[model samples]
Target: MRNSRIPFVKYLIELLIVAFGVFLGIMISTYQNNNRTEKNIKKSIGFIHRELKSNSQKLDKAIAYHYKLKSSFDSIKKELPSDLAMENYYTQQAFRHNKVPHWTGLGMASMDNIAFESAKISGIFQEMDIEEVQAISRAYSYFDSYTKFSENLMEKLLAIDSNSKVADIIVIFEVLGSDIIITEQRVKEEIDKINSQLENINK
Candidate 1:
């Protein structure tokens, strides 16, 4: 009696096809995972770039404000006594002096605002060369100088009375204002440089 069932070779061939199909499925799954990982990395980079751009603009504005105040304070200092004399200038003098535009807040946002932001950004892009780190450091250095100047100015303000405090305040403001201006300028440069580097990487 002959075997009427399907041929043994046909059964083996069907089994081989199923195995090949499974292997193909696995390859496809791995390819998709790799693609998804690449997409995630790109998205993260895009987010970082946007944040840097926003921070750069803020830093620019801050720099402008600092310099504007510095220039006005410079004028005010010139108009006031050249030396620290016991004269109640700003208070009693009823001097219709134009308030320094930048001094409206008279609050220091120096390091926390820009330098720290830069540093944080630098951390985000560790793949960058040491030059980027140095650029960030330069920006931070400017901010540090500005903050130190601010601290010393506050000390000077406390050092004197109403009679002498006015001149001291003027000096402090002038120095701080200048430092702020320098910070703004330096940060701007660094931001541009870092952003350029980042752009190259993304591109």
Candidate 2:
């Protein structure tokens, strides 16, 4: 008896063709999406790099300003012992360059984490290695801590009264003087580390 059915080989070939077409479509789609992601990563990195660089510059200025304040306070401390006779003069000098405003601005200033944050929000950070995410988080954590310090310093500054004792003012200055030096050193180190990581990512 003659078979009416199509050969099994013919069906196999047809099914393979369909499978290949589907696989090819998927490959093309994946390639395009990967390319898009790469572009986005590069663009975001560029923006982050620029913002970080700017922040570094601002920090440098802030460090200098704080250092100057430290020097001023040192001078004031020297004269404090005998300055009772020179009360008005020393008091005026002590209050001369109130660092509160600048420090407040520095504390309140925003760091550019837009790229990092957006990446997290969009789940791109999940694609990053755990170490990379950790490094970024650690860097930002330092900044957050610094912000809190600034807030505390601002409160201290606000609490200063014209009638406040010179000894009290001196104490605040000494604390700030030491704190800022430590902060400046740490900031420089962190910036260098973060910039190195960013450059690696850019490459």
How does each model score on TM-score? Answer: 0.58, 0.77
Q: What are the lDDT scores of the predictions, listed in order?
A: 0.59, 0.66
lDDT of 1 by residue, 154-178 (tens): 6765565545645455656765576
- lDDT tens readout by residue for model 2, 47-149: 6667667666766766777676677667655655555533442356544435433343323334556766777787766665687667767776777777777
> C-alpha displacement of 180 in model 2, angstroms?
1.4
- Candidate 2 residue-wise lDDT at 169: 54
| Segments of candidate 1 deviating more than 4 angstroms | 1-19, 83-98, 106-164
User: How far off is residue 120 in model 2, in Å?
Assistant: 2.0
Model 1: how large is the Cα RMSD against the reference?
6.5
Best model per lDDT: 2
Question: In model 2, where do residues sit more than 4 Å from their true spots?
Answer: 1-10, 82-110, 161-164
TM-score for predicted model 1 compared with the true structure: 0.58
